[model samples]
Target: MACLSLDLCVGVLLLIGLRCQSCAGSKVYSSPGASVALPCGTRVHGPCSKISWKYKEKFFFFRDLVESGKVIDMKMGRLRVGADCSLHISDVSFMDGGQYMCYDGATSANTTLQLLNNGADEVFAVVGESVTLLCSDSTSPGVGESLRWSWQKKELITANQGGDVTVSANGKKTEFKINPDSSLAIKAVTAAHSGYYECSLFNDSGLISIRRRILLHTLHETTDLPSAPQQDVNFTLTCSLTCAAACDEDINLTWSHSSGEQQQGGAVVKINNTLISQLLVPKSQASQTSTCVVLREGAEIANHKWPVQGGKEVMYSTCSVCYPRFLTS
Candidate 1:
């Protein structure tokens, strides 16, 4: 009896598959928090008196115009059916990806919905600094025992999958290393490397589970100071750090003096797609020197130093401007 039941189940599935093949397949692309309508059958088929929509063969909606319209097992209440037998879903999510079937009378149609996330998190890193791009499935954080991770930059030209299979273009893989957490750690970030980075998750059978992207911006800092200075003068020293885009971490700027004077605090920090830090100091009788330190994640990334112009003339032309009067004159 058990064998007979198994055969019957297979027969039913085969029949459903054949019915689905009668209608051409459709594909829809959408992101989370968006709404999409999946057409089950073209208008060639008149209004369906009896319509049903199923997800992977699991009933989701059933409507018999003459009988009744009823929602089935799914807890998500954001699904509805159009008079044309099309299924409309609102506030779609990652879990909503897969095959969907719309049954109208004796004819069945299928639609394959592809869910993509385009609003990737942005990251900014200084040139020559190391950075890690993150990708994860927080909505459905299911990591299979044999789960595999793949990393790609920009295009599919370079792909790394669990160290089992890798594709690179002329040693392009030398710059990036993948971590167990599916994060891509770049050894040294450069302007040439600024682009969209993607991470894909897979199962043991190499089936793609999820795909995400991260926008990385490689930044460079430039500092400007007045060429001429007078002693006991106040001037503004500006450091400009520019990137292709904005990042999550705020760029930290600190000012330090070489005169062994206690480093003063407070710098005006402004951020957008670019970061700017300004430091104001009083020029001393002797040429005082100060440096602007740019830090990210508590590590120094870039610095610029300038000699503050002093009122006193050098006793000798070759004297160091930033040195003390006793040592120079």
Candidate 2:
């Protein structure tokens, strides 16, 4: 996402019948899927009509939420005007986080809504394959602070302020290792190792750690036929996706063959908070590699390639295979 000079406007939101004097500026931090009320930052006194709200999204895109004391259409009723003329936002998302400006016709107030959540990351690996749950830092490390990593709320490792690190001996210790950069590296991950991993750093401001959650999933492939497809037999490679948590956006899965043939599934249904997509590729010709591409909002997020013939599978994340290590069977 590019952050340039703000000249963009989606539409106008108009709110009416609210009076304010002078609201103050504020900063609010919320997680994904929460409700928050952004004060117009105005102090009340006499008649201060014609209040409006504007927001600058994370990508520098500007949105007009209110215009002249009336609420416009945005988020489909998720945004509402409080009795006090504050902007009440429900079902907050990572995409909804940004800077906001409120104007009460005379005085204007500014606010910043910061969303505290993990990057939308999900790793797909075969069972028994070694994988690394990367903890990328966007903030510079401060002195006299520790970086801690946990899985399902259990603290498994810690990197002290002096940079010395230690892994716990809590039975699962042997299965995990802490890398020099503090990223959690698992020796060999089975199906049981699949879950959410959290890395956090605390400062006076709060959890400055940008990456708080990482999804790890072990894939178990099933074949329609008992044995592999031969020259005459047709092989259908099933490409699937399983959401480890609540999917924040619409995820679309597509199967791309080395032959340049691409097929995308329609209407990715969410069942039990998990999403699954499948495709069948017939091994008619000399099949080399079949790639599974995951897209959110029409952009590719992850690309996993496997041999339609026979070899190890590879998964590539954002910025050219962010998964730095590959394991052998």
Best by lDDT: 2
lDDT of each residue in 220-244, candidate 2, tens digit only: 3333432743656655555555545
Candidate 1 on 1-329: residue-level lDDT in tens? 13245435533553456544455676665567656667655334665546666666343332221212244544467776555456667787888877776665566666788887654554555555666665564433345422233333333322455422234534564466666665566676555555556555433323233345555555443333346765545666565555444533755667677764535645545566555666666655236666655566865554545554444322111212221110111
Q: For candidate 2, which ten residues in a row score worst on lDDT? A: 9-18
Q: Number of the top candidate by TM-score?
A: 2
Model 2 scores a C-alpha lDDT of: 0.58
Candidate 2 lDDT score at position 90:
79
Show model 2 residue runs off by greater than 4 Å. Answer: 1-128, 136-144, 158-174, 190-194, 202-229, 264-273, 310-329
